[model samples]
Target: MKNPCVAHRGWSSRAPENTMAAIRLALADPLIEWIEIDVHLSKDHVPMVIHDYTLRRTTDGKGDVKKKTAAELAALDAGNWFSQKYQGEHIPTLAQVIKESVGHCKLNIELKTDGIRYPLIEQKVLECIQAYQAESEVVITSFHEGTLYRMKRLCSQIRTGIIIDGWRNSLPKELKELGADFLSISYSKLNKERVELLKNAGIQIMAWTINEKRAIRKIAALDPELLICTNYPERWHELRAESMELEVVNRKK
Candidate 1:
């Protein structure tokens, strides 16, 4: 069975977080069976693949992502800050990323709604997914409950998940009510007891941004079937291989 190690932000530890350069590299690597990217509607209502609400952190632009038209967003240098060697790389629209990844691998497209909300973003993102006929290959997730609610209402058949970083007493009940397909939770919140709870509820679990070697092994030991979201998928693969090898040696002994 495949380990299902997801490349967070397109193998972001090596490439610029959400740029096409990152996405393309991840697609080319066979180790990365799943790629996670963030999505926000541009001013023109185009779904764009980017992590920040503002352009300052990842691109050379100055304002909010929703303020810029798709073309304007693509015009800025998104890779220069990561490294001068990647000077000309630009932000990719969600369509472009989907075009590159539709058949090669699955995507976990995060419906990014932080402080500034993009009104009607769920419909816009749905349009992009339908346009490419990638409804089956994508998993839409968000921290906002309303976003998931809207997405489920828009198309209940397409898989949707809720991203959680904290635990609450009502969580299992809330999740059961929400009817989410999976729970993408923070690494700190993942453990045997919680895993059993979610599994018993028939909810799939995904742990995110686990980059350290120790953390990777710990989670993999807890549940190898998890969709382990990591910045360095290469590291996860190495550790997974080592674990498998050790298991084989023990069996032979």
Candidate 2:
């Protein structure tokens, strides 16, 4: 199967990661078929686009993200950390993301677990998906096993991917039992033998945070069904050609 090239944190290189500008940049790229973004809840139980527990690093703020209300987070500058050109960009809501992404491109929402209020996050996320009728184009993923499990129970329609940062032989039995749609593991930890084994079992494998061309080539050779890459969305066409060329060379051998 042709692997889907997903933009990690949107086209993070073009704009601040997980912001409206980033989403716009990614959707404008024809080669980008899907985008992966992070989500977390604010003090008011509103789900917003962000990757960290604290806002100090990514935004012009200095506290835990969960401690701030949506209005407070909105007041901070989310873009200046990337570039001064976008100094006052506000954190986007899950509803805004869903609305904009509805028919444009597939979305992979990575639920951030640090300081999480599970029920609130799940409720807000599911509500946004329902509001936009985006169930067909959305997949929920998380590093938190509990979050993924709860998602599967709450909404079986949307696909679920368990994010693993380690190298383990046995796929989490709970993920399999809960009917997860796929497994997303770090590219550094995967082996070709395991890739083949998973493929043979009809389980989908998606490698995360792949950005380098060399790593892209290596993963393409393993032939996973999807690649969740960062910044590499800009080189989508070049990498795809590389994948095709590798296939031809393998066939001739």
Candidate 3:
């Protein structure tokens, strides 16, 4: 099991995070196998891809994302904050992303729940995945316990994951109880011992937001199956190329 790279927010270092442009760009690359994005329900109950509960950070709109309809959110410019080149890039619906990624790669959709819990978001997400029969193509995750629980109960066929920002000694038991297929954690909290504990628990680890060359290598070395979630997939790809080159040079020597 080689440590695989998951493009975080879809090559976010180069494009706007969670936009269709970023997602498409990552999918275009033959090297990207998995991509992670955030999903929030609009006022009309459509699942849209964007990180925050509010739209101010990534869009020209200035209010809670839940207040707007999917079309309304789509009208806002989601890509200009990163650069003018993406000025007209709008927020993409989860269905659009699923349709776009049907044959390309897998998606890890994070259910965004900051303060207010969007009612029936779980059902909406399940229905969306079911509409496409994409149980294998999508994995739903969230920091909220109840969201994941509802998702598992609704459709056990689709995988569910926990987005953890901290560690606990009883985490293995907790994850097992929650029926998490995988767990994504901060890179700072990941180490060999923690990886072993989860592996023994029959759970997979996916480390988040690790960008530096050395840090990515350090974490990937711990477990070959570990999913190295990064903003720039190119860095990881470059590291692999460099390692192979070094291996060749060493053989020659």
Candidate 4:
């Protein structure tokens, strides 16, 4: 199967990461089968789509995102830092994202709770997914192994993945114990051998945030099931077209 391209935080390279603008842009791209987004629970237990735990970086607001209610978060300007064209874009709720993207593309929701804990976050996320009837269209991932475990226990039908920055010697074993469906790793840490190992163990691999042509070619050669990229789904489409052309030429020769 041709590797699918997942737009990281929507078409984040062009729009404010995690804003509705980016999500809409990614959904419009036929090449983007999956849109990956980060989520943090607001004080009111609403799942707001934003990368950092703090609002200072991505929004006009200052302080921890947990301190703000969903309504307050909804009013913050999430797009001005990226460019003037996106001046008033607001952070979207998970429900809003799912409603917009259900039939258009799959969602890869990363639970951003590495250092902090949001009690019952897994349940809240699941409720949103169930409400939208998007069970088949969503994959929940996290660096927190405990969260994945809790997610599986809560809903065995939900597909889950583990996100890692670097190679882990015990990943295969942990995945089996955790019942994880796949592994999403930093593209810089991937190699053919590692890919083969995971594939042999019946685990799917996804490489993230890769944009350079050379890096894309290298990772593409490994044939990961998903290639997560920011702002450049077209580049992967181009590479796939070239690969198909090469195959056709070889057959003719």
Best candidate (score: TM-score): 3
Overall lDDT per candidate, in order of appearance: 0.86, 0.81, 0.88, 0.87
lDDT of 1 by residue, 8-89 (tens): 9997888898888888878988877889999998999899988888889888899899999999998999999999978989
Better of 1 and 3 by lDDT: 3
* Model 1: residues with Cα > 4 Å off, grouped in runs: 114-116
Task: Give the clashing residue pairs of candidate 3, or none.
Answer: none
Q: Per model, how many backbone clashes are there?
A: 0, 0, 0, 0
TM-score per candidate, in order? 0.95, 0.90, 0.95, 0.94
> Which scores greater on lDDT, model 2 or model 4?
4
Q: Judged by lDDT against the true structure, how good is candidate 1?
A: 0.86
Model 4 stretches with alpha carbons more than 4 Å out = 224-226
Task: Flag clash pairs in model 4.
Answer: none
Residue 154 in candidate 1 has what lDDT? 93
RMSD of each: 1.6, 2.7, 1.6, 1.7
Better of 1 and 2 by TM-score: 1
Q: What lDDT tens digits, residue by residue, belong to model 4 across residues 1-253? A: 2778888898887899999999998999887899999999999999999999899899999999889999999999999999999999998999999999998899999998863579768989999999989999988999999899898889998989999998977888889899987898998898878888888888877898888867788887786474555457777778888888998999999
Q: Give the runs in model 2 whose Cα sits over 4 Å from its true position.
A: 114-118, 242-253
TM-score, prediction 4:
0.94
3 or 4, greater by TM-score = 3
Give the per-residue lDDT digits (tens) of candidate 2, residues 1-253.
2567888888887889999989988898776788888998889988899988889888989989889999998888999999999888889998888898889898889998832454578778888898889988988888877887777678888788888887666774555776785777898888888777666656677787888877776776677465656666756568777768888999999
